[model samples]
Target: MSHGSSPSHLRGLAEVAAASVLWGTGGLAVQLIREHEAMSPVTISAWRMAIAAVVLLVALLAVRRAGELVELARSRPRQLLVVGAGTAAYQGFYFVSVTQVGVAVSTVVSLGLAPVLLTVAEAVRDRRPPAAGRLVVLVAALAGLLMVSVAGHASSTGPAPVAGVLLAIASGTTYALTTAAGGSISKESSPLVLTSGMTLVGAVVLLPCTALVDGPHVTTDAAALAWLAYLGVLTMALAYVLLYSGLRVVAPSTAVTASLVEPVTAAVVAAVVLGESLGPVAVVGILLVLGAVAGLGRPAAAAGPVLPDPDPVRPPTAP
Candidate 1:
């Protein structure tokens, strides 16, 4: 679709914003999965992907978009694989982030700073100025997040496990790469087909990987099962679709930056659900993150180390 041209594109942008909010709630759901479901992080990621795949297939059938979905399956197989692999990498590494750095710290490091990286990636990929106004907002948000993390209460899960922190950074990097990849890919493929097809591929990749590391096991406990269901269906499957759709509407940088809200919400949810504490520093960090978001409006327009390409993808010629 043409950038910000059609009314439909504008509507897609709204969808993307809503999807960001939906993704923000994922950490809370995972927290619930931990307490109620008593599942390990590895198990959580595995089940979330697997279960979501099944549910989405059903949803796809019901929606009757199966024909377009089939075409997606036939087209862009390589790109789809890369996107799926990226998805798997993100899931594997993200859990590690929480494991090493503590959920709050890791969340900020990975999710918090992801927008900045994504903006850089988006800018370079598109060869565009990326709008300087957005960069200023992004910097402010980053500053706020840093302060929040510095003063923020650490999760008892411990200072992000050394391994976990590394994994989280790696995950963040891959996530940024995938955002660029997905954005570019979407210019060719339908968003729905792209989202579902990539997810299906992600599930395939995770199947063996999950087994090699974490075996299949079901908890008979009602709460545990319920939490698992929530993560799988709501967070993994549905949330991903929402995010992919949003990517089509929102610029890769804006989409990625707006998503910083997820980690902030995670911090708040951790406090309420995990009973984690955050002092004045926590507030400051949150503000920094917000500043980062606000800053995006500026730097994005400037010629920088990271901004969209001048001619990202050519629009189709009028008939």
Candidate 2:
């Protein structure tokens, strides 16, 4: 079915788009948090997940879907682990990548690689080649992402670019796994349940690491607390709700591709808020990324859903 003809798909697209835009703010938020709070990326990530988990649990209680979380934990413990572990890995890896290569490059590699990895995974699972048109869209989107990454200036504080790229690639793979698993889990339960489970799991996994590695570095300043709250509430909790809501109708690969808007948003924010300058190439790159997302938003006749199985067998779930 064409996204244009389906109201659900349209809603899904908007939901995903909104989530991506909000997520774009995360890099800046982290930067601000860093300015006020002296903490490791892992510690910040731990706080983000822990706070988001608590918020999600409260939201579930309010909506009376708290049982879904318990049911998922009882029934699909492994998938829950997968989603949660993937989330923790993505955040930790991506944030470290940011420190190593800077936000634009790390964001590019982390967000950019998910769609390609997911698309390839879908093609391999389906035992069929991706449609030529869809492949074109993916290529355009990736090319655009690369343009933005290469054109944007990296922060001077980072380490080797190669290491950062590797870390970002790992972040992308973890994110792809999370997105794929999320789509699968949402099929059997509500988005709220899936998000709650994942957030809790991620919190559980990261909280210890934060305490062990960054025990002496935790910050409790008011400004730091406020930034963490914003990251947890808007970027993590609310963003995942929109993400999973969109996954109900959109393919996981497409959803990640749609989220490429993140780098664009980050670039603009850097320019306007941070007083960073974007050259002509960066402007062109931004347009390409925007174009790629637009192409994905339109109706496509041959595309199919890309959702991983909740089970470890990795079957493609039906949309």
**Model 1: per-residue lDDT, tens digit, 1-319?**
1122344334444455456556667767766666655556676676777787778777778988676667655666677789988987887788767656676566667765577687666567778755656666666666666566555544346653777777778887888788767876776565556777777888777766655554344677777778778777767676667667656545666666666666666667778777878677777776666555434333333212232322324331221
The TM-score that candidate 2 achieves is 0.88
The lDDT, on a scale of 0 to 1, for candidate 2 is: 0.80
Per-residue alpha-carbon lDDT of candidate 2 for residues 265-307, written as tens digits (9 for 90 to 100): 8888889999989988888888887777777656562134623
TM-scores across all candidates? 0.79, 0.88
Indicate the TM-score of model 1.
0.79
Clashes of each: 61, 0
Residue 293, model 2: lDDT of 76
After the best TM-score superposition of candidate 2, give how far the Cα of residue 117 lies from its true spot, in angstroms: 1.7
How much lDDT does each candidate structure score? Answer: 0.64, 0.80
